[model samples]
Target: MSRRVKNPTGMRVLITGASGTIGLALGRRLVEQGAHVVGLDVAPRGDEGFEVIACDLTDDDSVTTGVPRALDLLGGLDGLVNNAGIGGPAPAEAAPGAEVRRQLEINLLGTWRVSAACVDALVASRGRVVMVSSRMAVMQLPLAAAYGASKRAMVAYADALRLELGTHVGVTCVYPSATRSPIHDSTAAAGLSLEGMSTYEPLEGVVDAVERSLLSVRARRDVPTTRKGAVEFFVARHLPRVTDRIVLRTLADRARSGAFDGAALAEGVVARHAEEVSR
Candidate 1:
């Protein structure tokens, strides 16, 4: 049975990573629906047609002070979207432990900080929390271990939060498949490519999924965006060995192609032996 979500008209929502593609798109759509929206980002583009709260999720004082300031500005938050995150393609061996810690801080710990700060306000308003997790959280792929692990941890955290919060607040975890956005550019900048992951789903679809998650009264625990993502999620849950085989085979193919050496490329190694053979 399809669950219907309540319209968020006049509801106030605060979105982290509000300057990014997904965040901006979500803010715009919520605004169009008559919801009051506030965005938080370290380097937000000036004047996103809504209040942009300057926030650094990694900084303790910033999150502590900034979240309250945002609550003050918005009067109260009805929903909080933990949308800010970073991803790159680096083999686990190539990734430094420090770099992995940074990703954990920004992606997982940052979400925790914001949620802790906003819990009182959200509880007061009986609000909802939407987590922008990824398909990688469910179905893992090679060369992005940190990102996948962080997201998996996020999914677990959301489940725990939902159980803890009970009927006081709503929680929804969104799993979007690969979408065309600046995230890919950011990964490429880090010497990683997501080209073979999946075909880019429409960005609008992802935004719509977030909206639905926010509005749903009895929000489902998991929200997968694309059909393929739904299938993978199902397979990952039901047929673990099958999913493992598929992922391993895919990684094997990529490894054989020499296209998987993004960490080397990022370090300015122009011609790998694998690339030389492929060429």
Candidate 2:
């Protein structure tokens, strides 16, 4: 039988990005379930049940010191939810270097830094680590290169962390599909829309997944927040070319309709076709 970790009652947990939608959802749930929750974010807010720590994950000193501070505040950590991230759409090559770096700094390196800071404490507590990746990590889509790359890298990092931590620490990577949140605003600002993308799932479902990952003894290494995400993950893995074609078609139609700035997108499509032909 697979081993299991009990629900987080009376246990202390830390959630990064506590100001964001998913983080807030998870925090409220954890608090309701009797766990002492510590929240860390650049813009920490007043969460009634959570002790908030103002820390920028991208700042080396902030993460290095902030995590230990949270540990002190919470008494100790039984779980760490790495839920902080940013999102936007930009053609891969056309996207500014700084823009891509900003996402990577927060979504990938920031995650690594925070996890590293908390690893020793997590090991001591036999705690779980929940990484909030995205469905885009498993499947590439149009006009979102930086966002996709950061999420994909997050999954890879989680995979390695799980193996390394072994039985001492449980690591779960949750890949939430598009959700009804401010992320859509960012996507729109970046010149894209969700019209052709998968439907947004509710925030509660993603929170539940995080809870399950923390409590399940035999936790899955990779979890899709919904059935739609799971099926899409499978198709992306087994039928990549088909997925690519579908995405390309959608982008092509969007470009033809002048939905957003399609100049970069048209070039991107042409570039992709050329690469495929070469292959």
Candidate 3:
């Protein structure tokens, strides 16, 4: 029989990608709130005021071993946060390449590895699993098909997990809009930056949303970090064609402004937009 932690203060939580911008901030906040936090990252930094284990979520061996160590350190688990992910530009028209595979590996499979490993403990505690998905999961943008696909697939995984674990464990997916992070460095370096296409929200909102998902009495199915993010998620989920049109319009405008002029990865999209403008 599993017991629920009625008080937020002593809840034991494991957060992957604990060294990243959101992860660090989240870990700090949870510790401050009196929760016990254990972070897992490929590169562990002990200065984050929480115990961080060096775990590579993408590697099977690493996850299998590291998760148990974290569990041992925390004594038990109450929540698991799948927050590790990568980003790069992968155009839909182009053949799937390394970037696409890498995104799927980390964003989707990595989450799977961590979640699967934590299942037993979570079930034992009637704990919650919060997936740190992105707004891109619901709202697709041009020239970043890989990221969108991986994130969307993550949400699908979350849905399946919720159905399977709903009896004993709670599953929730948190969607955050673009925030200032190194995740976008690769895309920006490729000249396919999401600057004009998406608005940046404060990191605090995302942390708040994740906390809410973890601590809520009844877990929410889909939680967007900001009001704008909520609107985007609703529109994207309910009105697909509308979002497609909006994306196309945005792509065309960016193309006109030469945003994709020097971006080799965006050549296909830029040409398509140019053809549309010519018509």
Best by lDDT: 3
Give the TM-score of each candidate: 0.90, 0.90, 0.96
Candidate 1 vs candidate 3: the lDDT winner is 3
Number of clashes found in candidate 2 = 2
Model 3, residue 164: distance off in Å is 1.1
Candidate 3: clashing pairs of residues: none
Which segments of candidate 1 are over 4 A away from where they belong? 1-3, 261-279
Off by over 4 Å in 3: 1-6
Clashes of each: 0, 2, 0
Give the per-residue Cα lDDT of candidate 1 at 85: 91
What's the candidate order when arranged by decreasing lDDT? Answer: 3, 1, 2
lDDT of 3 by residue, 1-279 (tens): 113324679899999999999999999999998999999999977799999999987799999999999999999999999999899989898999889999999999999999999999999999999999999999988888999999999999999999999999989999998999999999999999998999999998899888888888887888889888888889999998999999878878898899889899888778877787789
RMSD to truth, every model: 3.5, 3.6, 2.9
Task: Identify the leading candidate in terms of TM-score.
Answer: 3
Q: Whole-model lDDT, candidate 3?
A: 0.91
The lDDT of each candidate is 0.83, 0.82, 0.91
Candidate 2's residue-wise lDDT over 146-188, tens digit each? 8999999999999899899977998888888887887678667
| Model 2, position 29: C-alpha lDDT score | 81
Residue pairs whose backbone atoms clash in candidate 1: none
Question: Positional deviation of 205 in candidate 2, in angstroms?
Answer: 1.3
